[model samples]
Target: MFVSELMSTRLITVELDDKLSAVKEIFESVNIHHLLVIESKMVFGVVSDRDLYKALSPNIGTRTETSKDTATLNKRVHQIASRRPIVLPVSATIEEAIYIFNTHNISCIPIVDHEMEPIGIITTRSILKALDEKKITLLATCKTQ
Candidate 1:
């Protein structure tokens, strides 16, 4: 199978200059875990929920919140994003994505075009889900034969 087949095209993006506060709002309001950071309409980096958690103070949004804690929100998306991400082309195979996941510590691989513009994203969960569905389909086909 190709990466494009299993990848998610519903991209949630943030610019390099976007604040962590904005990213926080997006994460809270949306079901997404990763946000693609773009520059000049090209994929620049990736920021995950875990990165935000680690960058921000735990005191944020609490009664004990301090100015120092809230200051973290003022940080830009570029500050915490994983730069120069390992990307894949649409034609890349699922095995290639798996190899990247295994060899790197990244959770998602942005699928880009020839210009390095992101078109989709593939995550470990997506791959596993696709594999499970394929297994079920195969079983069903075998039983019907």
Candidate 2:
């Protein structure tokens, strides 16, 4: 199967100049794990939920929160994003994605167009979900036979 077949088309993109607070808000309100960082309509980096967590102070929103802790939110996405990320074409196969995941430390791969603009995203979670669905289908087929 092609990566495009299983990729999540709903993308949440942020700019280099954008603040971490806005990214935090989006993550808190959604069920996503990664956000693409774009520039001039081209994808250049990625910021995962873990990255945001590490960049922010643990005391945020707590009674012990200080002005300095709040200042961390003012940091730009580029400051914490993984730059020059590895990307795959939408036409790439699922096996290729699996290979990349196994060899790289990254959690997700951005699916891009010819111009390097992100069209979709594929994560380890997506691959696992696809595998689970395929397993269920195979089990059903065997039972029918």
Best model number under TM-score: 2
Local accuracy of candidate 2 as per-residue lDDT tens digits, 61-113: 99999999999999999999999999999999887998899999998999999
* TM-score of every candidate: 0.91, 0.92
Candidate 2 local lDDT, residue 73: 97
- The 10-residue segment of model 2 with minimum total lDDT is 134-143
lDDT of 1: 0.92
Query: Hey, what RMSD does candidate 2 come out at?
Result: 3.7
Off by over 4 Å in 1: 135-145
Clashing pairs in 1: none
Evaluated at residue 19, the lDDT of candidate 1 is 99
TM-score of 2: 0.92
